[model samples]
Target: MSPDRANPPETSLTREFLAALTTFGAMGYVVVVNPQILSVTGADRHALIVITALAAIVGSLFMGFIGRLPIALAPAMGTNTVFAMAVAGSGVSYGTALVMVLVGGIVFTLFSASRLREQVVMAFPEAIRTGLQCGLGLFIAKLGLMGGGLLTRDGHFGDLREPSVMLAGAALLATPVLLALRVPAALLLSIVAVTLIGLLVPGAHGDALTHLPAAPVQMPPWPSDYTFAFDFGSFMNHLALALPLAGYFFLGDFFSATATLIGVTRRAGLMNADGKLPNARAAYLADGLASMVGSCIGSPTIAAYVESATGVETGGRTGLTAILVAILFTFAMFFWPLIAAVPAQATTPALVMVGVMMMEGIRHLDCSKLENTVSAVLIMLLTVTTGNLVIGLAAGSFAYTLMALALRIRVAPVLLLTDLLLAVYVALSALTLHH
Candidate 1:
């Protein structure tokens, strides 16, 4: 048989449909989360839809066509909240805030285009990289908890209560049951099912669910005053805040993107004949561009999602999967109202589940190797407890570097730079609580 003939088909439409559906299922958290963000920001929902759709299209093109990786892109949850509540609330107009995001996108593009993103990723020892993924996984899970109200703010002392407990419990139960039943889009299906039952079954508690339907998709507005207007004066007002947004938001993007790429690559089993990542520059560029597009739309920054990892688990190995997912995302834009029905409780379960899956990265660490163990534990702990990726990363790198130096292991100067950045941020956050 010819070698070319032996290759599996990578462009099946039916396969792509299934792939996209699965990818959509994985993205349930974002689907549920972003609308709330837009509403809170007081931005026009229709404009947010346009921005989200464009990000998906631009991102899919970058990943599927350019990077040839099966990944989806959209607004990041953590960064969006910061932009709305913190940045927007502090006096920076939405337009000026978006400019910062665009600037961030440009930085990511330049770094990624030069493949410096790849090098920065590579500079980390394999153990640290793996741990970072695990940390992000935990971070995502924590977000599910916080968002679902499973973890709530209590006066002086905090504890999980009744409704938060109920919703969280329902979602957690629903996902595995659907998965075991071989349900397609198990994560998303479970969320909807739980939300419906919770709403109809009596005593639905905490964050009421609203029925949503598929709506027609709309085009993004021309970069304009409403969408693209950037105010130089307001930009300067938030210049200091811009650094935090740049540092934490970019790190979050990098970590999420790395985790998404690694998860999909491993599942595709498309190891380079040498067992390495493929066309990483193309992948990172797509990621950077997606963020750029998202910013232009007045939404939060975009990043690769962990839910897409579940698509990989389902035998998705081609760009068609991402393309299919993008189509679903397009359809979702219209059904924003219907899709918005999911309560945080129903969805947090899936987030927690994905987090469990991501936590597997910890197994790769060698605690017996004190440095590796310390770094891994520190990264995971700080990521979960602090709810800050960059800070956790900084602490982990700081510990890792100190260990490396003390043990007389040769370390790279790039790592030193990473540690330096992390240290400075950690110190500042500690002193000012700006983080």
Candidate 2:
């Protein structure tokens, strides 16, 4: 690829802007979904919406300006779910959870600044990395289907008679057809089409649209309620609880961000000849800083979101795309009502399509090696089944290490150490469950 093709200049600003808009359309669901998930912790729903947007804005801006990457950032799905369901639901105060996030962010920053983060990334074999990408892809698609109500809890097809399901089905079918026709912003267009259909159709609840917001316009208020609300007393009083939760937060953020940066950058042809991402430390710093900012503003730990691939797929090659995403997130704050009116089903197609795109990494794996193939497949299966990326990665890493040792293959010492650490993490998690 030529220099212009690798890093397009401002001459391609229009294309970059459109790519960013496509990314926003694909990922804008986080504006509503984050608050819905975190509100389980006794958080005010309105307050969470503002905080979530603010976090995304800050994180994306950092990625654009400092990291100089096309990656967008947001409060991650799995971490937020764990924060609400495991941390707060387990009787820990919300403020204490924020403290855990803050501490975890600090730890993450330290790790990224040192050799530890690089070592971990280096220890991951090529096959395992490909597996991680494929697993995350499946995970993203599953989330889309589940959130859109296209798939039932038991993994069966949802009732298509339902208006939401029908709309989602239309989106699911329209996305690929549009892409095949080489339509620009096909994902975004499918979302808009389904949203319009949703608005016209009466919903299952006898409403104009069951998932639409009550109002279509509203001014967003600042989330003063949660800003700087960390409870040091609660955090310090429960070292045992805080330590484990903090570890979970740290590992989840670190691994997810690492995987996203690697997968997205490789897909965009940003990796160097040595398979290392250039200026990766800067990206990691941006991710860590985003998490810290999120904790301060009463949101979950923010990280580099894999959905940024949607923009990259659309010819986004530089920080310009991320800057545009940050601007849109800032604007989205004031358009909460309009955003909320677009149901989750409308965004389902984009997520599913992005997942399909990410799955292309599987082709790079050496499937002829049985150990590599088995580990990769296990990673994808466990990720979708357990709904946890950390668990899936850890399980796959351990399996890969053991299989390599049994086959008398030369294994990196770092990988063996990583397997030990993962074993300890799993044991701790099991103990926490029993407690």
Candidate 3:
């Protein structure tokens, strides 16, 4: 009998909306990044958008209705890039990459359903977890810079500000303001506010508004494009590349999702004594399904966004917020132009600010601890330098594990398992690079 068991249930509508909004944050990534992936793959952009949207809608519905969690499903950003630019880039068909994605998702789902997930969680030290979260912030902040054209490589690391300063400042200001005022739809609202400001003010480029190319990307109603084609022969040769990616992306996605959920639940005042929620499994399952379906639709795995914490902070204690988000996403498809009209400049600030905001999670971490500090520093350096989440985690985990072993530190079984998996990822990545 837990305190959560003793409490009254949240309202159904509220629950639905939270679930939908959570899903909406998950959906935003696809709208922002999938177009780029499609271009890299030689796939039709319009087909990809329609198919990806359909995939997100269907997958999100399944997670919302079937899984009964606040988790939203979508193509994951990290995995899709790896698939399109790295794995498939080496001659693997987009269809084949889709199959591998499915395979990875299946593996992740299995881990979630079984006790394996518990074991992995037990393996990492708290310091490592804190470091990873902080690293994710840096990782995302860098993305904002690249996305907003603030860090373009004119030479090295590029100029820190062009239009970036303005956009970043707006997002930075808006995020805190929205948080302080306790606004509903704070994530969406912040972006909208910044975009509005961008539109009203003369931008550095001197354009009040920028329009994305309008193309009606339609998916065939038939299932003709659904190919389960995988080159097993190529897979073996490329297993070195695929395995690390599979492990790294899976760990990063799941770890971030789990950490965010716990943080959000607590922030929403919905946590029990053990820090568990009623529909925790539902939320976790949604992440896996999002990744699985996103692959089929030519998108990356979409995980729970840290920014959605804003919704939770605003008293979104039910799933209704998530449901609202899903509905909004459905409508946004029709008004893709409006979404497109939001200049990258306007969006970058929020992302950069979000990167900064998430660093707060590290406060609970004792950086003074030797093992913790090593892992944290390693993760931060790798993240900033490589600009790769998976790489940073692998590097940090390896250092953490090696230090633990050298010091003969007795870590939890979960942490030990985490270290082992991270070791496997590091090894695989090394082999791939050597090959």
Candidate 4:
């Protein structure tokens, strides 16, 4: 092959920088939103802000330099909510939750380094994977609607008379239009626009867009109370509880990262003939390691952000895009006050839109098949209604396996084993709840 064939022309630095900037804009909302979700576990808000940014910085740097991939990593939205809910429901301290994350990260790292991870990914039939993605999308959208004040606690729509609710409604309507127009950083722009509207309009309840900080700029606070604050005693004392939580975290993180890698790489035309991502090991290792680092810094599981596709779509072809994102995140640490000033109403639209985008996976599923349609619908409904990704996934997997067996369809041994394991896990979880 000619040298030109062997080595593609280098991407323009201008394009790379712009792509990186766009990716950051698309994902930067995480810096504020993660802290908001996780703070419900009684974590210090300022500390969460710092830790969220720090985790993103660490994960993005590792993904860029070590993995040589254009993916950005951050404290994942779904898993962070899971962590907070687990802590609240189990009466566990935030430190104990961090310990669970640590344990999950270790297990994930081991899986990533071995062929086990690959096997697990392959075990899930394509239809099942699509179902999981769709379920998660709806789950995220539910959370967004709740956060935006558009939905009431009783699952009814909030009062349209409320200015905050009106702002959220506007954002919800505008975001899709912006996206449809192929606007760059459309989600981020929607957030800013909604926030600006909130600042200008006083709510019926006297709720302003956000409480402005005394200082527009200030040094980010150190997360001294949270850093390395794992509660080993609690973790060990509640081994049964901790084990399941860790397992759930591991499963969620692994599958989310795997799906993102597959989707992003395929879109970028970076997949090999065997349909495997180039440098897959490096990317997986980086993701797993980032989770561990995030745990140490008092954040939930960190994983590859699907928004990295924005950069790829903008011509990001190398590690440079990721590095730039890391650098931007590092700088973002100094702007904690401004980031924190963003209202939930502003960020909710992005989450909803992202959820909508994730649901696109469902289009690839064979909806004509009864088993496929039922399983997918069940997974989506259970995940949203139950408010637990693990339980939803387990129930769906078990249902799929049983249906396939009844129909005499060939099932992979690995998938069958997964189904059995999940059945046991669900039973144990029920026992725990009963006690």
* Per-model C-alpha RMSD: 5.0, 4.9, 5.0, 2.9
> What is the Cα-based lDDT of residue 138 in candidate 4?
86
Candidate 1 residue pairs that clash: 20-325, 212-337, 212-338, 213-338, 214-335, 215-334, 215-335
Worst 10 residues of 1 by lDDT: 152-161
Question: Model 3 shows how many backbone clashes?
Answer: 38
Name the better of 1 and 4 by TM-score: 4
Q: Write the per-residue lDDT of candidate 4 for residues 1-435, one digit (tens) a residue.
A: 432225553687888888789899889888877887787788788889899999999998989887777789999867887788778656778888899899989988999889889777667776677777788788778878988888876899978788888889888998999889988878878877877777787665686767677886788888999999999999887665677678768877888888888888788777766667767878889999999999998899999999999999888877778889989988889988877788888878888987788798888789777778877787788888977766777777777888898999888886776666666667877897899
- Candidate 4, after superposition: displacement of residue 102 in Å? 2.3
TM per candidate = 0.76, 0.75, 0.74, 0.90
What RMSD does model 3 have?
A: 5.0
What is the Å distance of residue 288 in model 3 from its true position?
Answer: 2.7
Q: What is the C-alpha lDDT of each candidate?
A: 0.65, 0.78, 0.61, 0.82
**TM-score of candidate 2 relative to the true fold:** 0.75
Order the candidate numbers by lDDT, best to worst: 4, 2, 1, 3
Query: Which is the winner by TM-score between candidate 2 and candidate 4?
Result: 4
**Model 2: lDDT to the true structure:** 0.78
* Maximum-lDDT candidate: 4
Alpha-carbon runs more than 4 Å astray in model 4: 1-9, 204-207, 237-241, 269-276, 410-421, 428-435
Model 2 pairs whose backbones collide: none
